[model samples]
Target: MSHPDTLIAEDLLLLLMDDEKGRLSASSQAQPLLGGALLVQLALDGAVEVEETNSRWRPAKVEARQVAGTDPDPLLAGAWETVAQKPRSAQDLVSRLGKGVREQLQDRLVAKGMLERRQTRVLGLFPSTVWPAADRQHEQQVRQRLQDCLVAGAAPDARTAALVALLAAVDQAHKVVDRGALSTGEVKRRAKAISEGAWAAKAVRDAVAASQAAITAAVMASTAATVSAGS
Candidate 1:
Protein backbone atom coordinates (compact mmCIF):
# COMPACT_ATOMS: atom_id res chain seq x y z
CA MET A 1 0.00 0.00 0.00
CA SER A 2 1.14 3.55 -0.72
CA HIS A 3 1.82 6.06 2.02
CA PRO A 4 -1.36 7.92 2.88
CA ASP A 5 -0.30 11.38 4.12
CA THR A 6 1.40 13.82 1.79
CA LEU A 7 5.16 13.38 1.63
CA ILE A 8 7.50 15.98 3.05
CA ALA A 9 8.64 16.82 -0.47
CA GLU A 10 5.05 17.53 -1.41
CA ASP A 11 4.70 19.96 1.47
CA LEU A 12 7.95 21.67 0.51
CA LEU A 13 6.83 21.96 -3.11
CA LEU A 14 3.50 23.42 -2.11
CA LEU A 15 5.27 25.97 0.06
CA LEU A 16 7.65 26.96 -2.73
CA MET A 17 4.95 27.22 -5.37
CA ASP A 18 3.25 30.57 -5.87
CA ASP A 19 -0.50 29.93 -5.81
CA GLU A 20 -1.38 33.02 -7.81
CA LYS A 21 1.25 32.52 -10.48
CA GLY A 22 0.78 28.78 -10.88
CA ARG A 23 4.55 28.42 -10.86
CA LEU A 24 7.36 27.48 -8.56
CA SER A 25 9.60 29.96 -6.82
CA ALA A 26 13.35 29.43 -7.17
CA SER A 27 12.54 26.96 -9.92
CA SER A 28 16.14 26.24 -10.69
CA GLN A 29 16.88 25.29 -7.09
CA ALA A 30 13.63 23.46 -6.33
CA GLN A 31 14.76 20.05 -7.55
CA PRO A 32 17.54 19.78 -5.03
CA LEU A 33 15.22 20.91 -2.25
CA LEU A 34 12.72 18.20 -3.10
CA GLY A 35 15.46 15.62 -3.41
CA GLY A 36 16.86 16.64 -0.06
CA ALA A 37 13.42 16.32 1.51
CA LEU A 38 13.21 12.74 0.33
CA LEU A 39 16.62 11.91 1.72
CA VAL A 40 15.73 13.52 5.02
CA GLN A 41 12.47 11.63 5.11
CA LEU A 42 14.23 8.32 4.63
CA ALA A 43 16.75 9.23 7.28
CA LEU A 44 13.97 10.04 9.74
CA ASP A 45 12.41 6.68 8.99
CA GLY A 46 15.80 5.00 9.56
CA ALA A 47 15.69 3.66 6.04
CA VAL A 48 18.91 5.39 5.01
CA GLU A 49 22.16 6.24 6.64
CA VAL A 50 24.79 8.91 5.99
CA GLU A 51 28.21 7.51 6.75
CA GLU A 52 30.24 9.68 9.07
CA THR A 53 33.19 11.59 7.65
CA ASN A 54 36.40 11.65 9.61
CA SER A 55 38.15 14.11 7.31
CA ARG A 56 36.94 17.56 6.36
CA TRP A 57 37.80 16.97 2.70
CA ARG A 58 35.72 13.80 2.40
CA PRO A 59 32.02 13.89 1.66
CA ALA A 60 29.69 11.71 3.71
CA LYS A 61 28.17 8.83 1.79
CA VAL A 62 24.51 7.80 1.81
CA GLU A 63 23.37 4.17 1.92
CA ALA A 64 19.87 2.74 1.90
CA ARG A 65 18.82 0.15 4.43
CA GLN A 66 18.05 -3.29 3.08
CA VAL A 67 14.41 -3.73 3.93
CA ALA A 68 12.52 -6.98 3.49
CA GLY A 69 9.55 -5.55 1.63
CA THR A 70 8.79 -2.95 -0.95
CA ASP A 71 8.71 0.78 -0.20
CA PRO A 72 5.42 2.18 1.08
CA ASP A 73 5.26 5.27 -1.09
CA PRO A 74 5.56 4.96 -4.83
CA LEU A 75 7.07 8.43 -4.89
CA LEU A 76 9.94 7.27 -2.67
CA ALA A 77 10.51 3.93 -4.35
CA GLY A 78 12.67 5.32 -7.15
CA ALA A 79 14.83 7.26 -4.72
CA TRP A 80 15.20 4.24 -2.48
CA GLU A 81 16.19 2.07 -5.41
CA THR A 82 18.75 4.65 -6.49
CA VAL A 83 20.29 4.79 -3.06
CA ALA A 84 20.22 1.03 -2.71
CA GLN A 85 22.12 0.55 -5.95
CA LYS A 86 25.29 1.87 -4.34
CA PRO A 87 26.70 4.06 -1.65
CA ARG A 88 26.86 7.55 -3.11
CA SER A 89 27.59 11.03 -1.90
CA ALA A 90 24.57 13.08 -0.87
CA GLN A 91 25.29 15.85 -3.38
CA ASP A 92 25.38 13.42 -6.28
CA LEU A 93 22.20 11.69 -5.15
CA VAL A 94 20.42 15.03 -4.74
CA SER A 95 20.94 15.95 -8.38
CA ARG A 96 20.33 12.44 -9.66
CA LEU A 97 17.16 11.84 -7.68
CA GLY A 98 15.84 15.32 -8.45
CA LYS A 99 15.60 14.87 -12.20
CA GLY A 100 12.00 14.57 -13.50
CA VAL A 101 10.60 14.55 -9.96
CA ARG A 102 8.71 17.82 -10.28
CA GLU A 103 6.39 16.55 -13.00
CA GLN A 104 5.53 13.49 -10.94
CA LEU A 105 4.84 15.58 -7.86
CA GLN A 106 2.68 18.06 -9.76
CA ASP A 107 0.59 15.26 -11.18
CA ARG A 108 0.00 13.78 -7.75
CA LEU A 109 -1.05 17.14 -6.30
CA VAL A 110 -3.40 17.80 -9.20
CA ALA A 111 -5.10 14.46 -8.69
CA LYS A 112 -5.50 15.17 -4.98
CA GLY A 113 -7.46 18.37 -5.67
CA MET A 114 -4.72 20.55 -4.23
CA LEU A 115 -3.75 21.96 -7.61
CA GLU A 116 -5.20 22.54 -11.08
CA ARG A 117 -3.29 22.04 -14.28
CA ARG A 118 -3.90 24.65 -16.96
CA GLN A 119 -2.62 24.33 -20.49
CA THR A 120 -1.74 27.56 -22.27
CA ARG A 121 0.65 29.04 -24.77
CA VAL A 122 3.50 31.24 -23.82
CA LEU A 123 3.59 34.32 -26.14
CA GLY A 124 0.59 32.71 -27.86
CA LEU A 125 3.00 30.41 -29.65
CA PHE A 126 4.93 28.23 -27.27
CA PRO A 127 2.87 25.67 -25.37
CA SER A 128 3.14 25.53 -21.58
CA THR A 129 1.29 24.06 -18.64
CA VAL A 130 0.92 25.75 -15.31
CA TRP A 131 -0.27 24.39 -11.98
CA PRO A 132 -2.32 26.79 -9.90
CA ALA A 133 -3.84 26.22 -6.50
CA ALA A 134 -7.16 24.42 -6.47
CA ASP A 135 -7.11 24.65 -2.69
CA ARG A 136 -5.17 27.00 -0.45
CA GLN A 137 -6.04 25.53 2.93
CA HIS A 138 -3.23 22.97 2.92
CA GLU A 139 -0.57 25.44 1.85
CA GLN A 140 -1.80 27.97 4.37
CA GLN A 141 -1.47 25.42 7.19
CA VAL A 142 2.11 24.71 6.19
CA ARG A 143 2.85 28.42 6.13
CA GLN A 144 1.44 28.67 9.62
CA ARG A 145 3.87 26.01 10.84
CA LEU A 146 6.72 27.92 9.21
CA GLN A 147 5.56 31.15 10.81
CA ASP A 148 5.39 29.52 14.22
CA CYS A 149 8.80 27.93 13.98
CA LEU A 150 10.70 30.81 12.35
CA VAL A 151 8.91 33.85 13.70
CA ALA A 152 7.38 32.69 16.98
CA GLY A 153 10.47 30.64 17.94
CA ALA A 154 8.33 27.57 18.58
CA ALA A 155 9.98 24.17 18.78
CA PRO A 156 9.50 22.30 15.53
CA ASP A 157 8.53 18.69 15.13
CA ALA A 158 10.85 16.41 13.14
CA ARG A 159 9.08 16.89 9.80
CA THR A 160 8.79 20.64 10.22
CA ALA A 161 12.45 20.88 11.18
CA ALA A 162 13.42 18.92 8.09
CA LEU A 163 11.23 21.20 5.91
CA VAL A 164 12.79 24.29 7.45
CA ALA A 165 16.26 22.91 6.86
CA LEU A 166 15.51 22.17 3.22
CA LEU A 167 14.04 25.65 2.69
CA ALA A 168 17.07 27.21 4.32
CA ALA A 169 19.34 25.05 2.17
CA VAL A 170 17.90 26.63 -0.99
CA ASP A 171 17.81 30.12 0.57
CA GLN A 172 14.02 30.02 0.23
CA ALA A 173 13.16 30.40 3.93
CA HIS A 174 13.11 34.18 3.88
CA LYS A 175 11.13 34.23 0.68
CA VAL A 176 8.47 31.76 1.87
CA VAL A 177 8.27 32.88 5.46
CA ASP A 178 5.82 35.51 6.72
CA ARG A 179 7.80 38.30 8.28
CA GLY A 180 5.12 40.06 10.26
CA ALA A 181 7.43 41.95 12.65
CA LEU A 182 10.83 40.36 12.10
CA SER A 183 13.44 41.37 9.57
CA THR A 184 14.52 39.05 6.77
CA GLY A 185 17.88 38.65 8.44
CA GLU A 186 16.22 37.53 11.65
CA VAL A 187 14.13 34.95 9.87
CA LYS A 188 17.20 33.64 8.08
CA ARG A 189 19.15 33.43 11.30
CA ARG A 190 16.44 31.41 13.01
CA ALA A 191 16.19 29.11 10.01
CA LYS A 192 19.92 28.57 10.00
CA ALA A 193 19.82 27.73 13.68
CA ILE A 194 17.08 25.16 13.13
CA SER A 195 18.96 23.64 10.23
CA GLU A 196 21.93 23.14 12.51
CA GLY A 197 19.92 22.22 15.59
CA ALA A 198 19.97 18.87 17.41
CA TRP A 199 16.44 18.06 16.39
CA ALA A 200 17.40 14.94 14.47
CA ALA A 201 19.83 12.06 14.50
CA LYS A 202 23.40 12.37 13.24
CA ALA A 203 22.58 10.71 9.94
CA VAL A 204 19.63 12.99 9.30
CA ARG A 205 21.63 16.04 10.30
CA ASP A 206 24.43 15.00 7.98
CA ALA A 207 21.98 14.60 5.12
CA VAL A 208 20.64 18.09 5.71
CA ALA A 209 24.13 19.56 6.07
CA ALA A 210 25.24 17.95 2.84
CA SER A 211 22.16 19.25 1.03
CA GLN A 212 22.92 22.75 2.30
CA ALA A 213 26.49 22.51 1.03
CA ALA A 214 25.30 21.21 -2.33
CA ILE A 215 22.82 24.07 -2.74
CA THR A 216 25.47 26.61 -1.76
CA ALA A 217 27.85 25.25 -4.38
CA ALA A 218 25.13 25.15 -7.03
CA VAL A 219 24.12 28.75 -6.33
CA MET A 220 27.71 29.93 -6.45
CA ALA A 221 28.38 28.06 -9.68
CA SER A 222 25.28 29.54 -11.29
CA THR A 223 26.37 33.00 -10.24
CA ALA A 224 29.81 32.48 -11.70
CA ALA A 225 28.40 31.22 -15.00
CA THR A 226 26.05 34.20 -15.22
CA VAL A 227 28.90 36.58 -14.54
CA SER A 228 31.07 34.94 -17.18
CA ALA A 229 28.30 35.12 -19.77
CA GLY A 230 27.74 38.81 -18.99
CA SER A 231 31.42 39.55 -19.36
Candidate 2:
Protein backbone atom coordinates (compact mmCIF):
# COMPACT_ATOMS: atom_id res chain seq x y z
CA MET A 1 0.00 0.00 0.00
CA SER A 2 1.24 3.51 -0.83
CA HIS A 3 0.54 6.46 1.39
CA PRO A 4 -0.38 9.76 -0.25
CA ASP A 5 2.60 11.37 1.47
CA THR A 6 4.83 8.72 -0.04
CA LEU A 7 4.01 10.16 -3.43
CA ILE A 8 6.29 13.15 -2.90
CA ALA A 9 8.18 12.59 -6.12
CA GLU A 10 4.98 12.22 -8.07
CA ASP A 11 3.64 15.39 -6.45
CA LEU A 12 6.82 17.19 -7.42
CA LEU A 13 6.59 15.88 -10.98
CA LEU A 14 3.04 17.16 -11.19
CA LEU A 15 4.10 20.51 -9.82
CA LEU A 16 6.91 20.80 -12.33
CA MET A 17 4.75 19.83 -15.28
CA ASP A 18 2.49 22.11 -17.27
CA ASP A 19 -0.94 20.46 -17.44
CA GLU A 20 -1.95 22.05 -20.73
CA LYS A 21 1.20 20.94 -22.52
CA GLY A 22 2.27 17.96 -20.40
CA ARG A 23 5.75 19.44 -20.31
CA LEU A 24 7.96 20.38 -17.40
CA SER A 25 8.28 24.08 -16.70
CA ALA A 26 11.56 25.55 -17.87
CA SER A 27 13.77 25.88 -14.83
CA SER A 28 17.48 25.44 -14.55
CA GLN A 29 17.04 24.64 -10.85
CA ALA A 30 14.76 21.63 -11.28
CA GLN A 31 17.44 19.05 -10.50
CA PRO A 32 18.44 20.56 -7.18
CA LEU A 33 14.85 21.25 -6.17
CA LEU A 34 13.86 17.66 -6.91
CA GLY A 35 16.87 16.47 -4.97
CA GLY A 36 15.83 18.54 -1.95
CA ALA A 37 12.28 17.19 -2.10
CA LEU A 38 13.51 13.57 -2.27
CA LEU A 39 15.71 13.95 0.82
CA VAL A 40 12.90 15.63 2.72
CA GLN A 41 10.49 12.81 1.82
CA LEU A 42 13.01 10.26 3.01
CA ALA A 43 13.32 12.14 6.30
CA LEU A 44 9.54 12.41 6.68
CA ASP A 45 9.33 8.61 6.36
CA GLY A 46 11.80 8.14 9.26
CA ALA A 47 14.23 6.43 6.94
CA VAL A 48 16.69 9.23 7.57
CA GLU A 49 17.66 11.25 10.67
CA VAL A 50 19.33 14.57 11.10
CA GLU A 51 22.12 15.09 13.64
CA GLU A 52 21.08 18.55 14.80
CA THR A 53 17.87 19.53 16.52
CA ASN A 54 18.47 22.29 19.08
CA SER A 55 20.08 24.78 16.75
CA ARG A 56 18.76 26.78 13.84
CA TRP A 57 18.71 24.88 10.56
CA ARG A 58 22.09 24.77 8.86
CA PRO A 59 22.39 22.97 5.57
CA ALA A 60 26.19 22.97 5.37
CA LYS A 61 26.65 21.17 8.68
CA VAL A 62 23.52 19.13 9.35
CA GLU A 63 24.29 15.43 9.07
CA ALA A 64 21.64 12.95 7.92
CA ARG A 65 21.90 9.32 8.98
CA GLN A 66 19.72 6.29 8.37
CA VAL A 67 17.36 5.10 11.04
CA ALA A 68 18.10 1.57 12.28
CA GLY A 69 14.65 -0.04 12.45
CA THR A 70 12.30 1.39 9.86
CA ASP A 71 11.50 -0.43 6.66
CA PRO A 72 10.41 1.99 3.97
CA ASP A 73 8.80 1.10 0.67
CA PRO A 74 11.06 -0.29 -2.05
CA LEU A 75 11.43 3.02 -3.87
CA LEU A 76 12.52 4.95 -0.77
CA ALA A 77 14.39 2.01 0.70
CA GLY A 78 16.88 2.19 -2.15
CA ALA A 79 17.53 5.87 -1.48
CA TRP A 80 17.81 5.29 2.28
CA GLU A 81 20.31 2.49 1.72
CA THR A 82 22.36 4.53 -0.70
CA VAL A 83 22.62 7.42 1.72
CA ALA A 84 23.51 5.06 4.52
CA GLN A 85 26.86 4.47 2.86
CA LYS A 86 27.85 7.36 5.14
CA PRO A 87 26.29 10.19 7.09
CA ARG A 88 26.51 13.38 5.07
CA SER A 89 25.50 17.02 5.39
CA ALA A 90 22.56 18.29 3.38
CA GLN A 91 24.95 20.14 1.06
CA ASP A 92 27.01 17.03 0.39
CA LEU A 93 23.91 14.99 -0.30
CA VAL A 94 22.02 17.30 -2.68
CA SER A 95 23.67 16.34 -5.95
CA ARG A 96 24.34 12.83 -4.68
CA LEU A 97 20.65 12.37 -3.95
CA GLY A 98 19.80 13.91 -7.33
CA LYS A 99 22.10 11.79 -9.48
CA GLY A 100 19.90 9.75 -11.82
CA VAL A 101 17.08 10.41 -9.36
CA ARG A 102 14.78 11.95 -11.95
CA GLU A 103 15.06 8.95 -14.27
CA GLN A 104 14.24 6.54 -11.46
CA LEU A 105 11.18 8.63 -10.58
CA GLN A 106 10.05 8.90 -14.20
CA ASP A 107 10.29 5.12 -14.52
CA ARG A 108 8.09 4.69 -11.46
CA LEU A 109 5.45 7.14 -12.72
CA VAL A 110 5.51 5.45 -16.14
CA ALA A 111 4.98 2.04 -14.56
CA LYS A 112 1.91 3.47 -12.86
CA GLY A 113 0.65 4.88 -16.21
CA MET A 114 0.80 8.45 -14.93
CA LEU A 115 3.34 9.49 -17.53
CA GLU A 116 4.78 8.38 -20.86
CA ARG A 117 8.45 8.63 -21.70
CA ARG A 118 9.18 9.94 -25.16
CA GLN A 119 12.32 10.52 -27.14
CA THR A 120 13.08 12.73 -30.11
CA ARG A 121 16.03 13.83 -32.17
CA VAL A 122 15.79 17.58 -32.27
CA LEU A 123 16.37 18.99 -35.78
CA GLY A 124 17.84 15.57 -36.56
CA LEU A 125 20.91 16.50 -34.53
CA PHE A 126 20.09 16.68 -30.84
CA PRO A 127 18.59 13.93 -28.72
CA SER A 128 15.96 14.90 -26.15
CA THR A 129 13.65 12.98 -23.84
CA VAL A 130 10.38 14.04 -22.27
CA TRP A 131 8.12 12.56 -19.62
CA PRO A 132 4.64 13.87 -20.30
CA ALA A 133 1.62 13.20 -18.13
CA ALA A 134 -0.62 10.44 -19.44
CA ASP A 135 -3.56 11.54 -17.34
CA ARG A 136 -4.16 14.75 -15.45
CA GLN A 137 -6.47 13.27 -12.82
CA HIS A 138 -3.88 12.93 -10.06
CA GLU A 139 -2.21 16.25 -10.74
CA GLN A 140 -5.51 18.06 -10.79
CA GLN A 141 -6.48 16.59 -7.45
CA VAL A 142 -3.21 17.72 -5.97
CA ARG A 143 -3.63 21.22 -7.35
CA GLN A 144 -7.09 21.46 -5.85
CA ARG A 145 -5.73 20.48 -2.46
CA LEU A 146 -3.01 23.09 -2.79
CA GLN A 147 -5.54 25.75 -3.62
CA ASP A 148 -7.52 24.82 -0.54
CA CYS A 149 -4.59 25.13 1.78
CA LEU A 150 -2.82 28.06 0.15
CA VAL A 151 -5.69 30.16 -1.11
CA ALA A 152 -9.00 28.98 0.36
CA GLY A 153 -7.71 29.22 3.97
CA ALA A 154 -8.32 25.61 4.90
CA ALA A 155 -6.14 23.98 7.56
CA PRO A 156 -3.47 21.72 6.07
CA ASP A 157 -3.03 18.05 6.78
CA ALA A 158 0.44 16.61 7.36
CA ARG A 159 1.21 15.92 3.71
CA THR A 160 -0.25 19.19 2.51
CA ALA A 161 1.65 21.11 5.17
CA ALA A 162 4.87 19.43 4.17
CA LEU A 163 4.22 20.25 0.53
CA VAL A 164 3.71 23.92 1.39
CA ALA A 165 6.93 24.02 3.36
CA LEU A 166 8.81 22.63 0.35
CA LEU A 167 7.20 25.08 -2.03
CA ALA A 168 7.86 28.01 0.30
CA ALA A 169 11.44 26.89 0.80
CA VAL A 170 11.95 27.19 -2.95
CA ASP A 171 9.65 30.23 -3.29
CA GLN A 172 7.70 28.44 -6.03
CA ALA A 173 4.24 28.41 -4.51
CA HIS A 174 3.10 31.20 -6.82
CA LYS A 175 3.70 29.02 -9.85
CA VAL A 176 1.25 26.41 -8.57
CA VAL A 177 -1.68 28.81 -8.31
CA ASP A 178 -2.80 32.22 -9.44
CA ARG A 179 -1.26 34.37 -6.73
CA GLY A 180 -2.10 37.56 -8.56
CA ALA A 181 -5.36 37.78 -6.67
CA LEU A 182 -3.54 37.63 -3.34
CA SER A 183 -1.01 39.99 -1.91
CA THR A 184 2.60 38.78 -1.58
CA GLY A 185 2.36 39.56 2.12
CA GLU A 186 -0.70 37.32 2.40
CA VAL A 187 1.09 34.45 0.72
CA LYS A 188 4.06 34.62 3.04
CA ARG A 189 1.81 34.96 6.06
CA ARG A 190 -0.18 31.87 5.11
CA ALA A 191 2.92 29.81 4.52
CA LYS A 192 4.47 30.83 7.81
CA ALA A 193 1.31 30.04 9.72
CA ILE A 194 1.09 26.52 8.30
CA SER A 195 4.79 25.87 8.74
CA GLU A 196 4.55 26.67 12.42
CA GLY A 197 1.48 24.49 12.90
CA ALA A 198 1.28 20.91 14.24
CA TRP A 199 1.01 19.36 10.80
CA ALA A 200 4.73 20.06 10.51
CA ALA A 201 6.97 18.06 12.84
CA LYS A 202 9.93 20.02 14.14
CA ALA A 203 12.42 17.56 12.74
CA VAL A 204 10.73 17.21 9.38
CA ARG A 205 10.46 20.96 9.06
CA ASP A 206 14.13 21.38 9.85
CA ALA A 207 15.06 18.75 7.31
CA VAL A 208 13.10 20.59 4.64
CA ALA A 209 14.72 23.90 5.51
CA ALA A 210 18.22 22.45 5.47
CA SER A 211 17.67 20.53 2.27
CA GLN A 212 16.22 23.48 0.33
CA ALA A 213 19.00 25.80 1.43
CA ALA A 214 21.59 23.25 0.39
CA ILE A 215 19.93 22.85 -2.99
CA THR A 216 19.89 26.61 -3.51
CA ALA A 217 23.53 26.91 -2.56
CA ALA A 218 24.45 24.05 -4.86
CA VAL A 219 22.67 25.68 -7.78
CA MET A 220 24.44 28.98 -7.20
CA ALA A 221 27.78 27.21 -7.03
CA SER A 222 27.09 25.28 -10.22
CA THR A 223 26.08 28.45 -12.02
CA ALA A 224 29.18 30.26 -10.84
CA ALA A 225 31.32 27.36 -12.00
CA THR A 226 29.75 27.46 -15.44
CA VAL A 227 30.36 31.20 -15.79
CA SER A 228 33.94 30.80 -14.65
CA ALA A 229 34.53 28.01 -17.16
CA GLY A 230 33.09 30.07 -19.99
CA SER A 231 35.08 33.13 -18.99
- The top-ranked prediction according to TM-score is 1
Instruction: List lDDT for all candidates, in order.
Output: 0.83, 0.71
Q: Ten residues in a row with the worst lDDT in model 1?
A: 66-75
| Candidate 2 lDDT score at position 186 | 84
Candidate 2 lDDT score relative to the true structure: 0.71
TM-score of 2: 0.82
The 10-residue segment of model 2 with minimum total lDDT is 57-66
* Tens-place lDDT digits, model 1, residues 130-212: 99999988888888998999999999987888889888887788888778889999999999999999998877787778877
**How many clashes in each structure?**
0, 0
Best by lDDT: 1
